[model samples]
Target: MAKLIKNSFSADLVRQAKFFKALSHPARLSILQYLAETKTCITGDIADELPLSRTTVNQHLKELKEVGLIVGTVEGVKTNYCLNTQAIKDFKSSAISFLEDLNIDTINCKK
Candidate 1:
């Protein structure tokens, strides 16, 4: 286990690593896709939309919510979930900046 030293190189790297880690799973990606398409959905609707069992879908949704990718509102027996638009935009901007910072265009590969 790597120790995360606050305000250090490894910690900063790990922080950036988590942005991709959050979307690394197919189930989580599916949940995001569904939420993006549907605008908003109840827990039951998500269960019905995916092939996974309800329990599995619920678990995946919980993870998505924890990562700030989704927001959930409990309404009595139902839970309404929607994508956190600001979070999504931040992720997009951060990813774009990270890639641009790599400056891959300068690579020379002439054979």
Candidate 2:
């Protein structure tokens, strides 16, 4: 038989971690919250509301898009951006279940 890798984690676990990593930035979090609250696609002007520069905002948007958190479409010169609702909901549900399944009582620690 071929040799097996020692790490217990699977590729899916690594992918989930990467998705969370995309959310670790405060700017990206703000973008997600804005999209959720609006509940509709937005085009431009959002960058002005934040302290960051337009380029920085665009970069953050690109990062969020790369992780499948948000969807963007170009209409003429304007690029509309909105949250991927299903993705967001799935992430939230999975995260809740993951957190709920933790068996903290099973740990035996001396403190």
Candidate 3:
């Protein structure tokens, strides 16, 4: 067994990593795009919009939900899903800061 080193990073970095991981999948991206386009809580089958199966879509939704990107509420037999605005805002801020930090005027290469 190896020791976990994830705790060594800052909380913000960890959170940003989680957000990036959740968005890394195309299915998850599509889900977010679909929700954003709908602009309302979706109680219907979200998988209908994607090429993947219901089970696969649900898994992607779980990842997004776990990362605080999406909220899923149990409404009777259906789950109402929507984007978590605050989390998205926070993610945007953190991601911009992180990306801006890497924005340099030039990069030096050594042979």
Superposed Cα deviation of residue 102, candidate 2 (Å)? 2.9
Question: What lDDT would each prediction earn against the true structure?
Answer: 0.80, 0.82, 0.89
lDDT of 1 at 89: 92
Most TM-score-accurate candidate: 3
Best by lDDT: 3
* RMSD values, in order shown: 4.0, 3.7, 4.3
Kindly report which residue stretches of model 3 are placed more than 4 angstroms away from their true locations once superposed.
Answer: 1-6
* Superposed Cα deviation of residue 85, candidate 1 (Å): 0.4
TM-score of 3: 0.88
Q: Give the alpha carbon lDDT tens digit for every residue of 9-109 in model 1.
A: 56545756776887888989998998888775545458888899999988888887877888898877888888899989988887887788889899998
Q: 19-99, model 3: which lDDT tens digit per residue?
A: 999999888899999999999989978988889999999999999999999999999999999999999998999899898
Range of the 10 consecutive residues with the lowest summed lDDT in candidate 3: 1-10
**What is the lDDT, from 0 to 100, of the residue 93 in candidate 1?**
86
TM-score, each model?
Answer: 0.80, 0.83, 0.88
Task: Give lDDT for model 2.
Answer: 0.82
- The residue pairs found clashing in candidate 3 are none
Comparing candidate 1 with candidate 2, which one achieves the higher lDDT? 2
